[model samples]
Target: MNDGAPQGWGAQSTDGVRLQKVLANAGVASRRVAEDLIVAGRVRVNGEVVTELGSRIDPENDLVDVDGTAVQLDQSKRYVMLNKPTGVVSSMKDDRGRPDLRRFTQDWDERLYNVGRLDAETSGLLVLTNDGELAHVLAHPSFGVTKVYIAKVDGRVTPQTVQKLVRGVDLEDGPIAADKARLLSASTGSATGREESLVELTLHSGRNRIVRRMMAAVGHPVVELVRRQFGPLHLGTLPAGRARELTKVERGALLTLARSATSSTPAEDAPDTRDGDPSAE
Candidate 1:
C-alpha cells in the first residue's frame, strides 16, 4: 500500500511507527479516526488484530489490513495541478457518460483522485494526488486552506453584498463567509444596463456549490466561475483541460499549508460531512 516504500517510512525507521499514524498517513482515514479503528479492533498487523492505539508496525515487513482490506502507502504519490475545463466532472471517472477529467489525465498510470472537486460547471485549479495524507490535509477545513475564484455574474457585484459575504451568510447547513472579495471588472450584460462583471472571491468553506449558492443568495447569479488559486498554487497560464505536476515551490507551499492545520478533528466551523463539490474548497 505504501506508494513504493510506504509514505514517510524512508524518512523514519523500519522498526515502524505508531499503527494509527501509519493508517492515517496512508489515507485510510484521519489519525483520530485511525485510532478509533484500532480501538474498535478493525485494524490488524501481520494477521493479528491490534487494538492498542500506540502499536508500532514495520510497513515493509508487516501486512496491515482494515476490515479485511489490505492497506499500503502509494509508493509513487502524485501531486498534480490541472487547469480544468467546463463541463468536466470533478472525478476522474464519470459513471453517467458525462464528461470528466479522464480525458485530461489519461496518461497517468496510477489512479489519482481529485483532491477536492470542481463541479462540471466550475473550472480552475484542481489538485490531483495519490498521497493520502496530503489529500486528507488539504481537504480538511481545519487547515483553513484558502482558495480563490473568479466569478462572472449576471449583475454588477455590490459592496454591500461583498460585505455580507465576508461577514458570513447562513447556508442551509451552516454559516460561511468569504475571506476576501474584489471587483475585477464590470460591463453591460447580455441585456442593456442589466450589467455583468467578474468578481474575485476567496474562501475556505467546502460546502457543495457554495459559490453559486452564495452569489445567487445575493441576487447576482453566476454565469461563469473559474478557480484562480488553491492555497498558494495558482492556475497561471495552463490551458483548459491541461494538467501538470506541481512545481517544487508549489509543492512545498502546499505541504506547509497542510501541516499548519491546528487539529486532527474538523474545526467547529467545518461542515459535518464533505460535499463532493469543491466550489469553495
Candidate 2:
C-alpha cells in the first residue's frame, strides 16, 4: 500500500539534501535501504515520522533518528573510549611535567578533551571527544549520568557498610550516596594480614574524590579505584593506556542519551572542575 513518493513530495523544500541520501552518507544504511526505511515509516526527522522519499533536511541542523537510534550526520565528529591508566593526568596538557593524555590522542588531528576526570591514581573508562555538547551532558552531575566504580579498600566490608553507603553519608562538601552498592570480594593479605575488600558502587555524582571520601567515611579507606562504566559505555576488555574509536552502535547509544538529557531540564552552568589532579573521583 506504499509508493516511493509520499503525499508531501510536492511541498518539501528543494534547498537541502534528500533524507535518504543524508542517512546513507552518514553510514546509517545504503541509499536503497534508506529509501526502503523511509517508505516503511521507520525514520523520523526532528521527532516526526517522515516517510516522504523526497523529503529534504539540513543534515547539520536537523536531528534524525532511525529505528529510535540517533543518526549522527556529521562525519567530522569523533568519539573515543580510553581505558586510562593510573598515574597519567586526565588533562590533555600538564604543566607539572607529569604523564598526560597527549600520547593517546596524537593519532587524531581533531583536538579532543576528556569528558570527565579520573584522579591520577585511579583508572578506567574515560571518554575523549571533540563533541562539546555530548561531553557536557555526560560530565555534568546535574544530568545524573551514572558511573560504575570498583574500589579496593582497606578492612573487611560487610552488608551493614553496603547498606550505609546506599542510605548515604555526609562529607565535607555535602552529603552523598551511592545509587547502588555491593561487596564484590574480601580477603586478608597473606603477609601483612591486613583485610581488603572490593566494593562496587554506582553513583551519579561528579564530586571530586567522592569514592575515596565515601569509603573513608564508612571506616574503610580506598586503596585503589577504577571506573568500570560511564552511562551506556562499559570498560569491558579494553586494556589500560589504550584507546579506540567507538563502534557505530556505541556512538548511537551515546548520542541518544545526550539528546534525551538535553531535552530535559537545563543543567547548571558551573564548569565540572573535577578534572584536575586529586579531583575526578
Model 2: per-residue Cα lDDT over 1-281, one tens digit each: 12123333322678678999999999999999999999999998777788888888777678888999998988888999999999998998889999998899987999888888898899999999988778888888888899999999999999999999999999999899999999999999676699999999999998898999999999999988999999999999999999999999999999988888877747788474334223488
Clash-forming residue pairs, model 1: 1-72, 1-73, 2-72, 2-73, 2-74, 2-75, 3-73, 3-74, 3-75, 4-75
lDDT per model vs. reference: 0.73, 0.87
Instruction: Name the top TM-score candidate.
Output: 2
Residue range 34-112, candidate 1, lDDT tens digits:
9999899898665568787757767555657777655654337678899988888876557898887777666788777
How much is 162 displaced in model 1, in angstroms? 1.5
Q: Any residue pairs clashing in model 2, and if so which?
A: none
Cα error, candidate 2, residue 223 (Å): 1.2
